[model samples]
Target chain A: MMTLAHTKYIVLAALIFCLTPIFSQAEGLIADQKFKADNEIFVTFSGAVDRAVAENIANYTVFEEPDPDIQLELESATLSEDSTRVSLRFKEPLNTAMTHVVSIRGLAGIDKTTFTVSKSYLGYLFGILISALLINNFVFTKYLGLCVFFGTSKKKETAKGMGVVFTLVMVVSALMSWFFYNFILIPYDLNFLQIVVFIGLVSLTVQAVDTVLRKVNPILFNSFGVFLVLVIANCVIIAVPLILANNNYNVFETFMLALGAGGGFLLALYLMSSVSERMQLAKIPPTFKGLPIAFIVAGQFAMAFLGFSGLQIF
Target chain B: MANDKSSMQLITRGILSENPIFKLALSMCPAVGISTTVMNGIMLGIAVLFVQVFSSVTISLFKNLIHPRIRIPTYTLTIATWVTVIDLVLAAYMPEAYAKMGIFVKLIVAFAIITMRLEMFACKESVNDSFWDGLGMGLGFMVGMVVIGFVRELLGSGMILGYDVLGFKPLLFFILPSAGFFVVGLMMAFFNWIEVYYKRSKGLK
Candidate 1:
């Protein structure tokens, strides 16, 4: 445990070392930015500019900061209907729950002037942990990682094995995706390639895990078997990291999220498998015998999980 | 080549015979995630339909170029590219509905159904056949989502597509995830019951 903690910090330091230069120039002088509930973030400048200039200002936001917590990424900018405001649309919707602080203080908007808007919303760390595990379980709530959960869920042993494997794989993959995304993708200006890169990273990691397990412990390797290959497409494996990177979790918070999500997946899978295994005895209709029945069972499990919605520890 | 009847058959098959979610159980993730509301289900269905049709046709168009050994990766890469582009384009261009679908739209990349179609039908089949199959399967998925979404929305919230027809919450559990499972299960059973009745009425079984 001590060694693990040490290595994490070591890695974090190395990552920050690589990322420092990327943030050197863009000290985010908040200027001429306005937020809209719809995906557009419109920046009104005092004067009008051509499309090319508007595009450049929007593109600059892409590499401005490497904060993983920043929810929105500027996909492109276009002139609004009035042709006065440069409407900046993001890759993802900005989280309305939090206030956005645009740091581009010195950077010029269409107005070619500097202005700032800041709102502080405190994110209690513990709140995130509880939320990830119970309220927003990747499996039960979000329905991610359902393929493997259903495919391997028929039998208790396979379900248990996949659960454990998934948990371990999710934690490691989350960290790896976070590291590469923050250090490499942001600095190198390949932010748009995130989905492809993250999926690739997950598949590669699964392959690596297979090879290591085969050499280290043959017992575990055979037990994991084809499910390892299946993990590549499991929504939770890629989605967790995607969620983490999008939320811009710090190392510790990301780790907690991984642990929470993994635990949630395991819990949901285990509960479903155990109950379904027993449910085989119940009399049922012919068409609903297999997959349809499983869906219903899953809905029941989801209701049980909904009970956790009020668990606001933070 | 087969007649026009075959194409109609292909399209209808997706709606019932080999329905992706209910019968085959290929991609249940989206079924459960977006089915909480009828609008969400419809929106996601349209998105999947667009992605599925394009992916199916693209794979068939480039079937020869993609090496058999690396086909899975190639197919995935293709799907990923389309999904990313669509996700961004929708978010930028259509802000309101885009906000509703959010990341669930991008999650289309991981859908086992799209990838399954590429491997099972798109690669071996001709362009026309693959196109029809993609349409059928995509339609099947969309219908399945709408059914589940409609059931959940009506009972869970006592509303359909944001309108409160029920005037009060029905079961509340019906809309929840657990209820989603039961609702899907019942629908599957209901469909199955229809199949049996149809066959019996025709003196087939």
Candidate 2:
């Protein structure tokens, strides 16, 4: 009897030991770190963190990964109403180029978890580039530039030319819009005028580029110059500036985004043109031969591109 | 009586023969992008209609003044101005409505159909004719959008206008972005087949 009772107690203890991790995992605090801006970090805990511990600035230590000696001065830590999230504001902008580490010192059950901001500036820019190029392609995913895309993509040579010209035009026009938006539009309290101003700016840029390209390099202009006018009022060109302005991206971020978008457009145009060149021979019903088939083909491509979604590339 | 007959024909033409989405196929971007739900289609359709009509009238009123060499830019500016005015007016007068539909108004600037109508119909026609053309084109586009949305929403979500109808999603693919192209493509083909069959029955080419 003594041996049997001892064996039963041992079995109970072993079961409890096996289930301890599961219980802790369900109850323990999990911190999700997100960079809201250069100077703001939002940390969301899995469970409600204690109000005093979360609000205490001393409980947190933030520093750039490369330079741990210089601790960032946490100006204020604002806890959300439910105590699940906390907003930590710093005196200076955290160096986005480097990974940032935030360590919670005295939370009750959390063992001084040092949560690191996952993506650095380069990583963030890369994310944007990949996202624009593959995940959320302007042409395939967002459905911009379809008119120009369909019009010019019938032939590979024209498609290639249009793609290069489009990238150049997009990059230049996006930069100009950025300069105008930051220097002119914001300072004068003319936010309401962005649509009109962006349209005017795009038209001016295209015209100016047309003239300058024709004068500077006639051969280059002749190859793709005809497409310059068509670029104006193109949704893709207009969307980049509007997006950058809305997100308040800085100069470098804007440049990267424009490059990615332009590159993505070019990639899409090239792929579609290649497929269409081969599709010239495919037999089909008369009704599905032209634009209808093109759309269906595009739908197939869109389905293929959908595989790239939810990919983490950092 | 002749003027009245022509006016009626002009308006009805946009609705039937020259329907923007089905017949002309000018603005496929919004038709494919924003026609995921019936409400979205209606809202965007109304915004496009407002901008299209106003810009057409404004351009038609001043077509003679615009230089032929720079008319494209002028047309674009006119469209942009109308879009801005609509945005501002809605934001000021109807804050709640603006919050829902304001973004659609701004996107009107880039829609090809608006500028296409301005160049082809409005600039060449008189103000009264331009108004009718805009209304017809707008209504046609709205009808096209509603049809696409109705089909997509029905198949995609098993619901219509947020109400569960089918009890389960039929074809989940219809809700995805890729399905937009397929739906539009199939719809276009269907329309083409109908036109051909109708012509055959009427003893016309």
Candidate 3:
């Protein structure tokens, strides 16, 4: 009986060893390589890259001319055990060929890490939808643009108009933030000025959007622009890009985050407006008449959204 | 601007008549964001209280010196300076709290409560009145935050002050931002109900 047990134990150990690699292999690492210019490539190996190859590649760069516009700043670089993947960062965009070279390196004994130049259009769309409704939820997560959110949301029709305007403003603001951050700020190495720059951008964007909308479509713009100015200085627009920057999400992810934040703002506004409309008729006490009740309602809504915290749908 | 009674009245006004979050509906920014937990609410309240009192006192003392045309700019500068000081202190001493609070600390500059009080009361009132008004409003805001924080933390985590008070599992919905609105609304309704009951029983006014 003792000998039989020993044999079973050995078989179990063998099975565990065999199964471990299969499970580990199922989740392949992704190596992302970005080309900023003709001479510079930013390589990030997510899963596993060969340590020797990564070191060799770094040494080769020392002898080579540095690519203009692609100032390599190693944000973080890591190599997994077994020398399967490597990740690196560059300050600027790289040309496509370097990315392809990194991809080939993965195939050469390193674990295969897929590198796609651009995310699918459908992926972008889906990401936008999800981001608008969930991930970087504006009202819930950022507490931005609340003045307009609470102010115009007192009535349903006004709330609807404000919601549309807020979303448009957010999209415009996000695009502006992206342009400023990527084109000017990052290039100039003025990332520390992000807060001031983004806030100014948001204020300018709101004013520009207001002016354009008013001229192009007066009726619609009138409905929305009333609250647009109010939300211009609000932090939601700038906060979205700040979050995207921290997460280091690609353009697709940034778009999604914008969508989620916008959607979340609209959701909060709609809910608050509907409740406030109902609340208008409710017999509230003199002391707790207007703002007090609104505060309480806002608190309750915030609590309700807490349910979505652990949801890993993203 | 008046005697002790008026000064005392100005102070009391913020606690009820001009309560920042509840009565006046100002400074909803930090109120909603940090009211997720009781601890956050308390910390934020104390921070705001400190800033408000000191800023109000400063504004009142320097009110005559500030130009009328540039009063808004000067007020903003003053508030920003105070906020920056708070920000630095928090960054140095309470790094964890500072990390969690994030940009909201800097946002104190734009918080309508501090600015509104500075413009409306501090600029016009005596130093003592301004100080009391700031304290009252700060306390009122604190009460608002604590109420929301208590409900959110309790229902969301099945705990109060981080202690599991109820054996029952928490309703996760109570912790999200949406729930912040709901909890605040329900609490307001409760407060309203209590006030109504008292008024009806006493036939007051």
The C-alpha RMSD of each candidate to the native structure, in angstroms, is 11.6, 16.0, 16.0
TM-score for candidate 2, residues paired by index: 0.78
List DockQ for all candidates: 0.44, 0.47, 0.19
Candidate No. with top DockQ: 2
Q: Tell me the spans in candidate 1 whose CA falls farther than 4 Å from its real position.
A: A1-127, A285-287, B1-5, B156-173, B200-205
lDDT of 2 by residue, A1-314 (tens): 99999999999898678655533331246556667877898888887878998899999999888678999999999999998999999998775545688888778656696767745555777888888889889888888888788778888998889888888888998999999999999999999998999988888888899999989999999888888877875788888888899878877778888998999989998999999999998898988878898899889998899899866565
Residue by residue across A1-314, what tens digits does model 3's lDDT show?
99999999999898677545423322244444433334344455444445665544433221112333433443444454555444444444433322132333434464433334332344444755664575446676567666556677788888777677777877777877887888898889976555556666666677788788889999877666677756644557656767766555556557667767777887888888889988988897676677666766766665566555533321
Which candidate should be chosen as best, given TM-score against the real structure?
A: 2
lDDT of each: 0.76, 0.84, 0.67
Task: Report the lDDT of model 2 for residue A56.
Answer: 92
Residue A89, candidate 3: alpha-carbon lDDT: 46
Candidate topping lDDT: 2
Query: Mind giving the per-residue lDDT tens digits that candidate 1 earns over B1-205?
Result: 3334477887898878888987787777877676889888888888888888899999999988988888988887888888888888888888898887767887888889999988988888788888888899889998899888888888889998899898999788766555666776687788888988999999999
Clashing pairs in 2: none
lDDT of 1 by residue, A258-295 (tens): 88888888888888889788978988767778777787
Would you list the rank order by lDDT, best first?
A: 2, 1, 3
Count backbone overlaps in model 2: 0
